[model samples]
Target chain A: MKPAMLYKLVILIGILITGVADAAAHTIIVHPSLKVKNISQALQQAHNGDTILVKQGRYAVANLGIDKSVTLLGEGYPVLDGQMKGDVLIVNVNHVIIKGFHICNTNKGSLRNYAGIRCESVKNIIIENNRFNNTLFPVYLPKTSHSVVRNNVINGSSHENTTAMESGSGIYLWYASDILVDGNSVSGQRDGIYFEFSNGCTVSNNRCKNNYRYGLHFMFSDSNTYIKNIFSDNGAGVAVMYSGHIIMLQNRFEYNWGPAAYGLLLKEINDSRISDNIFGHNTTGIYMESCSRNQFSGNNFNMNGWALNILSDCTGNRFDHNNFTGNTFDVSTNGSPEQNSFDANYWDKYAGYDLNKDGIGDIPYYPVSLYSKIVENIPYAITLFRSFVVSLLDKAERAIPSLIPVSVIDHHPLMQQYRKS
Target chain B: MLKIAKYTVYDIARNKIILSYAIFLLVISLSLFMLDNDPSRSLSSLMSVMLIVIPLVGIIFSTIFIYNNSEFIELLVAQPVKRSYILLADYLGVAGSLSLAYLIGMALPVTIYAPGTTGLYLIVTGIALTFIFTSIAFFCAVISRDKARGIGMALLLWFFFSVVYDGLLMGFLFLFNDYPLEKPVLFFTMFNPIDLARITVMMKMDIAALMGYTGAVYRDFFGTSIGMVFTLILLAIWAVIPLIIAVQIFRKKDL
Candidate 1:
C-alpha cells in the first residue's frame, strides 16, 4: 500500500474496531445455576453499555458498586438481599438503570445511611419498578441531577414497631436538581420523599402515607412543584420549610391528627402558589409561620382543627376564592394579621346575610374567633369545647367585634361554597 | 313505686309544655337536617341546640313539676309508701319522659338523617344530661320550701354549669397559662354534667382535632373502654348522689 493509503487504512480499521466493540455490548445473564451467581460478579464481567439480566433467585449481595455505565435488569423481580449489611447497590457512574428488583434488608442503623440503591454524582439514572422493603434508605441520590425515580414502592419497616427515627427516607435527594420523582407509594418511612437543597424538582402522583414524619418534606428547595399527591396519616403531613417559588396543586391531605401535625406546614416559604388543594381532617390544615407573599386560592379546608393557622409572622399572603367549611376554627392567629388579605371565601360559620341579592354577604366575615384566640393562648381551655359558656362567649364575641383580630376578615364573603369544576 | 311512676309519666305526658318542648325539638332538628345535605354539618348544628336546650328544659321543667306536685307528694306521704319510693318514682317519671322526648325528637331525626357514631353519642349524652339535671332539680325542690326559691336555685345551678362554670374555667386557664393545666381542666370537667356530656359528644365530632394535645389527653382518658366505663360510673354517681340526698330530706320533712 502507498504511505497515505496505509494511514487511511489504519484510521478506517480503528473506526471499524470501535464500531464493532460498540455493537458488541450484549446482555449477560446471571443465574444461581450459572457460574456468575451474584450481582458483583456480573458487574465485573459486564462492560459499559452492557445489560446484566439477573434471573429469579435470591442474591445475597451487599455494597455492590457499579462504576460502569450499564443496565441492571431483573427478570421476574429477583431478590437482592442486603442481609442487614451496607447498601445493596451503589452506582458511581452515569447512565445507570436499576429496575424490577426486590431490594430488601439493608442496614437498619442510621450511621451509614445504607440504602437499597444509592447513586452519587451521576446523571440520567433511572431507578424504577423496584420494591424496597425494610431498607434504611430506599433510594438515596446525592449530587445527582436529571434523574427519574418512578414507580417505586418503598416500605421502610416491614414490622410495624419501627419508629421513624430508626428508619430513613423513602427517596432522599440531597443537592440534586431537576429530579423527577413520580408514582411512588412510600409508607412507614421517616419523611416519605425528602428533598434537601434540591431545586426545580417535580414530585407528582405520589401517595406518601403512614410515615412517622412528614410525608413529603422539602427544606431549602426552591421552585419545586408538587402536584396531585396524597399525603395522609403522616406524623406532620408535608412540611415545606425555607423554600421559595414552590407550587403545590391538587394535593389531598387528610387524617393527620396530632398536637404538632398539619396538612401543610409552611415556614419561611415565599412566593408559593398553593391552590386547588383539599385539606380535610387534619389537626391544622395549613399552618403558615413567617411565610410571606404566597397566594392560596380555590382550596377546600374541610373538617380541620384550624383551617388556616396563620401566625402573626405570616405577611402579604392572599387567600381568596376558598371554601372553609366544617372546620372548628376558620383561622387562628397569635397577634394581629399583617396585610394578609382574605376575600371572596365561603365560610360555613359566616352568619352574615346577603341582603342585596348578590352572592356576597353585606357584612364582612371574620374568620378568627374569640374562642380560637382563647384556645391559642390556653390550649388546656379546649377541654371546655362545646360547653355552653364557650359557645355563649363565642356568640357574644361574634355579636360584638371583640378579642378576635378584625383585620383578618373576608370582605366579600360568598353565600355559597365554591364548587370545584 | 312503679304505679306512682306510671301515673306521673301519664300526667306529664298530658302536660302541654312537655309536648310542645318535644315538638319544638323535633321541628328544630328536622329543619336543621333539611337545611344541610351533609349529615355531619346538620348534626353539628343540632348538637349545639340540643346541648343548650336539653339541660335548660330538663332543669326548669323538673323543678317546676316538683313544686306543682307538692300536694301529690303530701298525699303520698299520708299513705304507707316510703318517702324515698315517692322521690325515686318522681325521678323515674321525670327522667323517663324527658328521655323519651329526646329520643323521639333528636334521636329519631338524627338516626333518620345523620345516622353514625356521632349521632349515637349525642343521644347518649342527651339522655345522661336529662337524668342528671332532673336529679339536681329534685334536690333543689326538696331543699327549699318556697316555690320561687326552688325554681330560682335550679335556674342558678343551670346557669352555673351552662354558662358560669366554663367562664370560671376560662379564667383559671388564662390565669395559669404558663402551667400545664390539662389535668386540672379535665378534673374540673368531671364536676359538671353538662361539660362531661359536651366532651363525650365532642369526641365524636371533627372539632375534636382542634383540641390538639389537650384532645390527645382527653382521647387517652376517654377514648378507651376503661375511660368510658369511668365516665359512665361518674355520671351514674352524679345522678344517684343528688337523689339519695333529696330522699333523706324528703323523709325528714314534715309535709
Candidate 2:
C-alpha cells in the first residue's frame, strides 16, 4: 500500500476501535438489596468507561479505591460511610467523575489526613453536587491538576469539646494547580477551603463560615483568583501568606471578632490585587506584614477595630478610592511605613474643608491619630475609648501634626464616600 | 416636699439660663443631625457633646442655681419642713428640670434622626449623668458656705471626672504595660460615671469592635441586658449616695 493509504487506514482503525469501546460502555446499578450489594463488587464487574449507578442506601465502605477512568453516579444520593476507619474513596487514575453522594465519617482521630474523597496525582477529575458530613478532610486533592469541585456542602462534626483547629479542612488542595473551586458552602472545619502550594487556581462564590481557624487559607499559592466569597465568624478569617500575583475581588469578610482576629491577614505577600472587598465588624480589617506592591482599591473598610493595621515592614502598597467609615482607627502602625501611598480615599473622620466643591478635600487628611498609636503601643489603653481626654488628645495631635506618622497621609481625600460610578 | 419641689421646678423652668441652655442644646443637636448625612457619625459627635457638655451644664447650672436660691432654701429649712425634705426637694427640682431639658433638646432630635437602642441608651445615660452631677452639685453647695468656692469645687469635680481621671488612667496603663489591665481598667471605669456612660454607649455603637479584647470584656459585661441594668442601677446609686451624705450633713449643721 502507498504511504497516504497507510495513514488513512491507521486513522480509520483508531476511529473504529474507540467507536466499539463507546458502544460497549453500559451502566451497572448497585442497590442494597440487589445481588451486587457492595460497590467493590460492582467495580470488579465494571469496565474503564462504564458508569456505576448507586441507589439510595447505606454502603459501609472502607478505603474504597477507584483506579479506572469511569463515572460513579448516585441515583438518589447514596450514603457512603467510611465507618470512621479510613478514606471512603481514593481516586488514583485520571478522567473520573464522582457526583451526588453523601460522604461521611472518614477516620477522625487519625494522624493521616484521610478524606471522604482523596484524589492523588489525578487529572481531569470532577467532584460536584455532593454532601460531606462529619468528614476528616472532605475532598483532599494532592498533586491533582485541572479539576473542578463545585456545589458541595461540607460540614464537620463541630462538637463543642473539639476545637475547630484540630479538625481537618473541608476542601484541601496540596500541590494542585489549575483547579476551579466554586459555589461550595463550607463550615465547622479547621479551614473551609485550604490551598497550599497550589498555583493558578480559581475559587469563587464559596460561603465559608464558622470555621475554627481561617475560612480560606492560602500558603505559597501564587497566581490564584478568588472572587465573590463570603467569609464570616471564622476564628481568624482568611489568610494569604507568601503568595504573589493573586487577584482577590468582591469578597465579604465580617464578624471575625477576637483579640487576634483579622478579616484578611497578609504576610510576605507581593504584587497582588485586593479590590472591591468589604471588611466589616472585624477586630482588624486587613493586617499586613512585610507585604509590598499590593494594590488595594475600591474596598470598604467599615466598623472594624483597626481598618488597616499595616506594619512598618509593609511598603510600596497603594490604597486608593476606598471607603473608611465607622472604624475605630482608620490606620494603625507600630512604626512608620516607608513608601505606602494613600490617595482619593473617603474617611468619615476627615475634617478638612472642600471649598471648591470638587468632591475632594482641600487639605491632606491625617488618618493615623495619636490615640491609635497609644492604643497600638498599649492595647489596654483602648479602655479610654470615647473618653473626653482621648478625643481631646486626638484633636490636639491633629492641630499640631505631631506624634502620628506623617507618611501615611491622604493628600487628596474624597469629601464624599467612594461610589462605583 | 412635693409642693416645694414643684415650686422649685417652676422657678427653675422660668429662669432664662435654663431656657437658653435648652435652646442651645436643641440647636446643636439639630445641626449635628442635619449637617452630617450619616446618622451614626452624627450620633457619635453627639456623644462627645453629651460627654462633655452635659456634665458641664449639669454641675455648673445646678451649683449656680443652688447658690442663687440660697435664701429660699434657708427659709424652707427654717420652716416646719424637715431639712432632708428641703434638700431632697432641691435635688428633685434640679435633676427633673435638667433631665427634661436633655430629653427635649438631645433625645427628641436623636429619636427623630437615629432611633435605635444606642440612641435610647445615650438618652438614658445623659439623664443619668445629669442626675448624678446635679446631686453631686447639691452636695458641693451644701458643704461650702461661699458661692464662688462652691462653684470652683464643682468645676474641679467636673474636670477631674471628665478629663483628669482618663489622663491618670492612661498613665497607669502605660506604667503597668507589662501586666494585663483589662479587668483593672473595667474596675476603674466603674468608678467614673462618665467612663461608664461612654463605654455603655460606645458598646452599642459599631465601633465597639475597635476596642478589641478590652471591648469584648466590656460587651460581655455592659452589652448584656442584666449588665446594662446593673450599670444603670450603679449610676442611680452614684446619684443618691452623695445626696444622702449632703442631706446628713445639712441636717446636723448650725445656721
- TM-scores of the candidates are 0.95, 0.95
Across A239-354, the per-residue lDDT of candidate 2 in tens digits comes to: 88999999999999999888778899999999999999999989899999999999999999998889999999999999999999989889999989989999999999999999
Candidate whose DockQ is highest:
2
What is the DockQ (computed on Cα atoms) for candidate 1? Answer: 0.51
Error of 1 at A320 (Å): 1.3
Model 1 chain A worst lDDT run, 10 consecutive residues:
A384-393
Q: Note the residue pairs that clash in candidate 1.
A: none
Per residue, candidate 1 scores C-alpha lDDT tens digits across A37-99 of 878888888889999999999999899889989999999999999998889999999999999
lDDT of 2 by residue, B62-174 (tens): 99998899899888877899989998988898899998888989999999999999899999999999999998898898899899999999999999999999999999998
lDDT of 1: 0.90
lDDT of 1 by residue, B172-234 (tens): 888999998878888998998888888877777955374475778888887778988888888
Q: Could you tell me the lDDT of residue A137 within candidate 1? A: 92
